[model samples]
Target: MDKEQQIAPSAGQKGEEQHAIDVGTGEHGDGGGGIAGDAAEASENERLALVEEPGKKKSTRVAALDAFRGLTIVLMILVDDAGGAYERMDHSPWNGCTLADFVMPFFLFIVGIAIAFALKRVPKLGATMKKITIRTLKMLFWGLLLQGGYSHAPDDLSYGVDMKKIRWCGILQRIALVYFVVALIEAFTTKVRPTTVRSGPYAIFHAYRWQWLGGFIAFVIYMVTTFSLYVPDWSYVYHIDGDVNDGKQFTIQCGVRGHLDPACNAVGHVDRMVWGINHLYMQPVWIRSKDCTFSSPRTGPLRTDAPSWCLGPFEPEGLLSSISSILSGTIGIHYGHVLIHFKTHKERLKHWLLMGFSLLVLGILLHFTNAIPINKQLYSFSYVCFTAGAAGVVLSAFYILIDVWGFRTPFLFLEWIGMNAMLVFVLAAQAIFPAFVNGWYYDSPGNTLVSWIQKHVFINVWHSQRLGTLLYVIFGEIVFWGVVSGILHKLGIYWKL
Candidate 1:
């Protein structure tokens, strides 16, 4: 009695017992509704006590996810804002590697990770379906708007549009298409149910299965179209039927061929018809059967020039390649979700290391087999595997630092601008900031004020076009990031759409 009575008199004991019993409990003993009430009361009393006995203040900073997102947006801004910085901070050589190449894939993976959290908040069935539809439509409209309306450029949608140089599609267009498809998977597939009082069926929709299937199917279709569709083949149920060119091969070439090809009975005719036009103008950046660019040189009979091939059969957003691009984003989301759910450092590291090795090995295998050549413009399956795999490794590293190590860094500068990444990317792509820089305030000459200044004053700057272009683009990027950061700071604006 003496020992128990003496122990019960401790100050912490009094606070703990006072607050503990009144709090409600779930099966796990985690506090419930009553705990929230108790916490509120405790907070109020603590605040009053603090006021009575003033103490030092503590800092309130953003979370690790916020900082990570901030850093991502900064890199995205830098890469997308590049107007003509193709030499310096641009995507890598077709079959090579570069820093800029990882930016888009990183964005996609982050989107996936983000969706894991977002989908949890959305209600099931009716409301969720509606949300998915609305969000998908909005994404589509936003993508189109970002792609810009009909362009005055030669290949841009007019009746007289040039088949060779059409600006038929772009980044946002690809993003929207992928987001819509991936959204459907996230909404319907990855769902959790409370199976029992103690445990529940943690069913992940296995959306990656669908993603892989679609990617492979698209690759197969593309390969068929590239090799067999264009060539004469007749050992199966499907036949070229009647060869009839309806001017479609050339006209629909720039638009939605992925959806159109299988439906149209006149694919062979259309392909052959466009074969001439695409060869003369569109230039195929890649052909299906060719082992290498050298193996099937343009000088060969009926072969198209590499430069022209670069333009035709595929735009960066060609419907076929678009399939792979969307898959890349979807795959990215998969990696992001895995990082969020995985508990241990060793588990994440093991996963990432295995994935890295797999990608590197697969890339090497493809390089030799000439199966799905690792080309960026085409966004080949192997390229997606290699790049996305590499991105997984990097993302795992980020997850470790932000979620496990609990370290924070200078992110206010980036977070201020990154929250609205899509909006910023579209604006920066249009050179809105660069245009402002070229205005009266900094008006001098040479595209940007920075350039003008560099030319006039910093005359001894580097001679490389890549170097000059890099600095020029970076100048615009800094100015853009700065302007947006200030506006966000003043208004306290952070957005998701």
Candidate 2:
């Protein structure tokens, strides 16, 4: 397949038909001569004709979607590099939304949208499934290699790699799983019949019955499993008392009624049992410090160093919560269908707004009614709804401003970043950039280059150490990667799995 075809499937469409306006030369195609020139001109004419056709859906690429994905990637890098500097920039303690929390959902939502556009172009299911499986495995492997497994000690910064204790799941792992699940659902449910029947405002619903039903089923399953499942209550156990050599002790318990506790919850319990505490995230918010400790009045001491909510260990991106992550991706798939299937720009925008509003209202109702609290750790139904709603609104705004109003000039940089998203992300997170920052250092102070720069430049300039450190890391990564992406884009070097 060609570069456009490869990138199109992974994110938004960027095929020949969907070419963005040439901001540089104010012309389409590479402006070559001979057979290549003739073919490019013919293709451009066909695209223009398609756009001018009344009532026919536009086949051009959605620039706004690419920009949106680019924006998500930028935010992901920023928040990930923030290193928990500000409370609002990190994932919420237990419940509610944070700037950081919104990034993953937004990325997943965009993935769903991309899936719709990508799969529809391919006629064969086998080809689509193969692509999905390969991509999923690639992401899972990288996530494990990069963010998973062993971590360095905070104090001594000692490096250790323990296969037995390596973390099993992480951000890329979740994305892979979620994408694969949603793609499977789409592969089976996507209609073979062309979307010819337009039912006014219900056009999107009528067009995607199978996708809608699949999403509904996934959502229902998520809610039922999260709220109705019975979990063990370990509130009574203060702390385990046993000799290290003997390993014999009587465990105590408070016998709490429900499973919302961190340790006893279904998600955490399953993770601990399957992966072990050593494999789970060692420092979750629920178990960070003494003040964050959980105490059961019915069990032992009033306060214990042990975390109240979590008894053993838990992972936010664990197996159970992945159900909801799939649901989130399913929602994105629906949005993707809207983008591809809908005929008119206005019709698409209207449906997007309606979907956004409906989800926001439903999420609020679910949270307020206490049916399911908006918890990111749990990937609660309410959290999915709210975040998806927010994502829709944000995407719609981008669509309007960038694609609809032809305000593409200002966001060309983002387009550059979007074009080489996975390349930049992997480089920033796993390979070259991070290694360079950590390994390349000055000798005098014996600090990493990043730390030295932050201390000397950003910290010295800003005076407030915390704010300067945070700003330097976040913006420094963005600018560095932005420049790299821009260079790659200019060279027409786009990477894909």
Candidate 3:
């Protein structure tokens, strides 16, 4: 695997080829109409109308898409670097909903949508399967690495690092896993046509079919696992719960570890083992499994919180649920891709409004199904469906107004950030800053700038700590993007993942 794989590919040949098919018309929009030929012509016309300079238009790229991506990234940075300010932030109690809760799922959903565009490109260019494979693996490895890797802590912060107790999985790991699975399906579905001027053995491949099939299979599997598999196991438990603890804590957090795995419950039993006993660390929800809430390291005789048992790979967006996430992304990609091919303004607007409302309905419906649960933490299936639908609506609006209607002036800043999302996110959130730099650049000078404004510039700047922190982070994000816009203007690295 290599670094290249760590990043998802850009919307490649598919966008280009689709455009090529609809070329000629200076104003064709991909508003999901009937003919590819006519749509291409209209798209050409629309493309020409957007910019006076031929080179600058392509260089500037899709303003709407960039704006959406940028907005998502900004929110991500705000949520992640919340900076010890919880009060001002909106958070649901345990199994509840809050405004901030939507950010993660939205991010993952976007990643899936991006994959759709990338996969579309893989086939047309005849990109090698080997390259894709290598890239996917590399990303997976880095994702895991981001989770904590061999070290307990993820780089350094004010909080001390603990190597022995590092979490085994996290956001990057999830991204890697999802990307690998999606890429694999895409590769299997697409095939290389035998080229007379090239290779001898290759014929043709449906590299994309597998992704479609796999997506269906994954959904079915999630249903089976959540409904049939876990339900039965839970049902088998004696009615003792009916008379025992009345606490909502009836919801167990460990599976297979309490009674099923004696060693996990008795931590002392494995003291001599080399990697320590991972039984307590293997939570069912964290990985692909037919169980849930099965590990409790504290009850395992350790009688200590230090080497606390793993939280059971318990993810809001575990393997079983990611199916919905992928679906959401696929919808966005397809909708965006198809819309860009429309020729007539009226037709484009009609499709955009219709699809937008349809998706909004689907999202609202999915939100009610507590079965899949609307949880951003697990990237729950229902969450994906709902969020994706909403994202589509948003994308459609952007497509119609900015791309089709040429009303793109208001979102230029967001588009700038969107063009370089990954870099912006990593640089803003994960990149470490020394204490001195934080004091000099952020606290001291930042306060001066803030004071120059109308609002209070100190700790009391906002009514709540969390609000102040959020505002501060947002300010940081804007500054980062400003620097990024300048660099991009100079170096032309607009979309380097």
- Prediction-by-prediction clash tally: 8, 8, 49
Report the Cα RMSD per candidate: 12.3, 8.0, 12.6
Query: lDDT, candidate 1, residue 216?
Result: 58
Clashes of 3: 49
Q: Rank the candidates by TM-score, best first.
A: 2, 3, 1
Candidate 1: how large is its RMSD? 12.3
List TM-score per model, in order.
0.61, 0.79, 0.61
The whole-model C-alpha lDDT of candidate 3 against the native structure comes to 0.43
Best by TM-score: 2
Give lDDT tens digits, candidate 2, residues 1-497: 23222223323333332332221111232110111123354356435533322554444556777787778878877766664565456676676677778888887897777666445544576766766687788788878876674443122233556786688988889988887877677676655535454667775666677766766776777666655666554322223356231332223253433355454566666576677656777556554323353331111232444434434446988877877778788788778776655545676788898999888888889988987778788888888999999899988998888867778888876777776777777776444555545655567324777676778888888998768868786667777777777787777566654
Residue lDDT tens for model 3, 1-497: 22112111233223433332222110122211111223444355334433223344332134465566666766666655562355223333223344556565555555554544344434333343554455556545655544443422222223533555544445555555565566555445545411111212111112233445656676666554444432111111112245332222222323332221211221112221323322112332121111222232111221223112222223343444454455554444444334333333454356545665765565556666534345554444555555665665676677666765568777766666665665565555454332224433334444433333314542466666556656666665565565676467456454332
Candidates' C-alpha lDDT: 0.45, 0.64, 0.43
Per-residue lDDT of candidate 1, residues 451-476 (tens digit) = 56556433347766545555655564
